[model samples]
Target: MKLLLFDFDGTLADTLPICIASFQEAFLQVDGVEWSEEEIEDILGPPETEILRTYTKHGDPEEAVECFYETYASLHPKVTADPAILEMLSALREAGFFLGIITGKARRGLDYSLRQLNMEGVVDWTIAGDETERAKPDPECVDRALQQFRTSKEETMILGDTDADIGAGQNAGITACAVNWLPGFTPKPLTLTPDAVFRSPEELRFWLYRQENPLDG
Candidate 1:
């Protein structure tokens, strides 16, 4: 593929705990609502405002979003990306692939992560949560990334940990690579009919590079 679009949260980083905690805290502080872990996971890959609005009674969305980020940002030190994956991305960039992110994270969250993981050089463009009216399971974000990279759907791929990302890529007429990295998250993407499913970064790296690496054969 000439372009690779990635999902942020579970796919790139282990932000599950921090995101769930932030959601619970934001709901409690904003609307006195208590969100269980299951509820948070059900709506994990969406904009902060979109998730907040679902539980909001009389509170403002902007305020809840602010609260969520305040908590999420504080837990930034806990969030981490696999160094091997970072190296793989760098290799892809060096090989002339147009890499970008198509994530449900807000601009602030995505920016914080890109900086924290030192992915700014690898990720040439980003289509954040607030950038699109429709998120994952919809093709707008992926389409935007395709436009930015000026690549056709046949020459692009989407890699993510959830079916939503696969669905988005499918909706955009591209191959979707499902990542089964997070063990605790149930309902594997294999059942979701992804074009390809990778269990680890190493496997993905090998597969991706083999297409262009003469040494692999």
Candidate 2:
């Protein structure tokens, strides 16, 4: 593909643990309510600010969001990308594929995680949840990337770890691939089937390589 879009949380980095922890801490601190991991995950797909505003009951949403960011930053040292992700991204770049990120994470959190993971300048473009009018499963974010990159749907692919990502890609008429390499990751039932499913970065890279070298394959 000429353009590849990725999801941030479970796809690019193993930040889900910290994300869940941060949300729980924020909710408990602000609302005096202890949210389970599943509860927090159920509220994902919006910007942190929106989620806080909609869910925080006993405190200011803005304040709760600030707390969330603080917790996220403090817990960030434990976050890490897959060892092979950097190599795969570099290979894609060398192959003239434009890389972009379409994530439900706010720009602030995404930027922080990118910095912490030493992934700054890795992608050519990023469309954060706050940047789009609607989140994934709506196709707005994916459409933004396609417009910005001037890439046709047939020339693009979206790789992610969740149903929302696949749904977004399908809604946008692009190739959607599911990467399920993260441990303990159980995606919600997918309303839309993915174009392909990969179990590892190496497997995905090989598949893309074969697509680019069909004769060799």
Candidate 3:
């Protein structure tokens, strides 16, 4: 079976804005440093500490990390899965592709998004930043997802919208599919070199199906 590992926030759902709002709220409660909309959008998807370390330089890193989660917790429940994404996920699963979630978000956030879309059992496994010893840009989590799905690297594909996510996939020797849904939202203009890049679920479908069935034969 082919494994199809997905990144939760940008690839599967539109949780970036909610996550940014959550992080900002987390900071506001602590130093009231006032994270701007641009700042919030810029800081999406990386491990929480990276953002805390980079942006919360005004405060103690330890305290800022704690505050970061507190604020994110406050807003996570309100986040919803983008419907187009959910439909694509459903179709992919139905087609017998082994599916998994590999994300920087914690288990609580993953569960919330799955529950929001009634997809608790849709994916074979999930590995969150909080659930792993190392996060994205590292192959550990991606390896775990492949182990859970029992798929080989060649048969598995990793999808996300960031360079870090691509790094993780590359580290694990999985095919990287970079979704261009929100690359501009990151801190830097993340110029990614994915094995494949798609703009929407429909585009993804065409891409995957074409790859899986290339000939008129």
Candidate 4:
């Protein structure tokens, strides 16, 4: 079966605001530091430790990580998916595709969001940043999903909204698509250009089915 590997934050759900707020809360509560919006957005896609380090002049990385989780967990469900995203995902699942997540979010954070969105059943697997030895931009999670389904990268596609997602797909040797969910919000392309760029899920839907059935493509 063709595998569709998705990135959680910024892709499936709109958790960027809560994530930035949680990190800032951690920084303020733990170290009396505050980050500008630009700073927060700049560090959103990397590991939690990296985001913490960027906000700190001198502080314990472990402490910041703990605080981040604590604050984020308390703020779960504050953000949600686009109205049609879950339906689109369901259609893809029923279309004979294996659906999974590869995200920089922690397991607890990802789980909470998935549960609130009532999507735990549709997703087959999720590899959180802390769940594996390596995270996105490294592609180990994507490869892991490929292995789980006994499929090859040739039969896989990674859809995400950031550069790290593109890097992960490149690392795994799979086709990648850069999804621009927020129109007029321009960010630099991932270091690698994706096979396609889509502005909406409907656009991605057509592209995915085409990729899934190459003869029909």
Candidate 5:
């Protein structure tokens, strides 16, 4: 593939704990409601505004959104980047593939994560949640990335760990590769059928390298 688009939260970085914590903290502070673990997981993959709308009791979710973001920013320092994934990104960049990020995270959160993870040059482009009218599960974000990369659908692949990610990729007419690489987290439906699934970063790296040199394999 000429271009590789990636998802942020679970696929590239391990931020599930921070995300869950910040989400719950925000709701509790704004709506005075406590969400169970299941409740939090069910609404994950969408934009913060969408998630807040689903659970917020107030007239507007703006305060809750602000609280969530502030909490997430403070907790973001605890999130860590996967070394193997970072290595794969470097390898893919060196191999001449245009890399981009299409994530549900807002620009501020995405930028903070990227800066903290020190992945400034790894991705050629990025389309965060606030940048697009619609988030993942809709093709808008991926479409935006495709336009930025100036690549065709057939020459692009989307790699992520959620059904929404795969669905967004497929919606954008690209290959969707799922990665079950998050440690200590298991998605509810284990049987999500994407175009491809990689269990680990090493396996994903191998597959990406193979894509770069198909004849060698």
Candidate 6:
């Protein structure tokens, strides 16, 4: 593929732990409620602001959002991207592939993670959850990226860690690839199977290399 779109949280970086911790802390601080990791994952498709607005009971949603950001930033240093993922991204970029991110995170959170993980300037474009009228499983974000990159669906692929990411890619008529490299991640049953499923970053890198260099394979 000439253009690659990646999902951020569980795919590019191992930020799910910190994300869960941040949400739990935000809710506990704001609403005096302790949310389980499953509870947080159940409501993960939308932006954190929307989640806080919809789920916070005893406090102002805006305040909860702020608290979430504060907690997230505090916990961010504990998470880091796998070196192999960084290597794969760099290789793809150097090979003339346009790399982008299509994430359920808001722009602020995405930017923060990029900076913390030392991934700034790695992606050519990004479409955050709040940037689109609808979240994943809707094609709006993917469509926008395709438009911006001027790449056809046949020349692009979307790699992610969850079914929503696959659905988004499918809805946008692009190849959908799934990776389950992050430990302890158990995604719900996919409504549609992905075009390919990879077990690790290295596996994915090799697969993409084959796709790009069929003669080498």
Best by TM-score: 2
How many residue pairs clash per model? 0, 0, 0, 0, 0, 0
- lDDT per residue for candidate 2 within 62-110, as digits (tens), equals 8899999999999998767666888888888987999999999999999
Model 4 alpha-carbon drift over 4 Å, by segment: 49-63, 182-191, 212-217
Candidate scoring better on lDDT of 3 and 6:
6
Residue-level lDDT tens digits of model 3 in 1-217 = 3888888777776667777776776677666678887877655655666666667656676687777666655666665556777778789888988788889886766776677657688787788777788778889888888778777888888888878889899989889888865433442345767898777778887887887888944
> Over the stretch 1-217, how does candidate 1's per-residue lDDT look in tens digits?
7999988787777776888899899888987889898888777767776778766777887789899989988987876677767877787788788888888887888887778766676778888898899878899998888778789898899999787899898888998988866544443334478887887777877787776685866
lDDT, each prediction: 0.81, 0.88, 0.75, 0.78, 0.82, 0.88
Q: Higher lDDT: candidate 5 or 6? A: 6
Candidate 5 per-residue C-alpha lDDT over 117-177 given as tens digits, one digit per residue, 9 for 90 to 100: 8877788988888778877789998888888889999999998888888889888899999
At residue 126, what lDDT does model 1 achieve? 81
lDDT of 6: 0.88
User: Candidate 5 regions off by >4 Å?
Assistant: none
TM-score, candidate 2, is 0.95
- Provide C-alpha RMSD values for all models, in order: 2.4, 1.4, 3.6, 2.9, 2.1, 1.7
Q: Give model 4's TM-score versus the native structure.
A: 0.85
lDDT of 6 by residue, 1-217 (tens): 8899999998888887888888999999989999998888888999888888999999988899999999999888888778878888888899799999999998999999999889999889988888889999898888999899999999999999888999999999999998887666655656679999988777877888898789993
- For model 2 the local lDDT of residue 199 reads 81
Angstrom error of the Cα, residue 198, model 6: value is 1.5
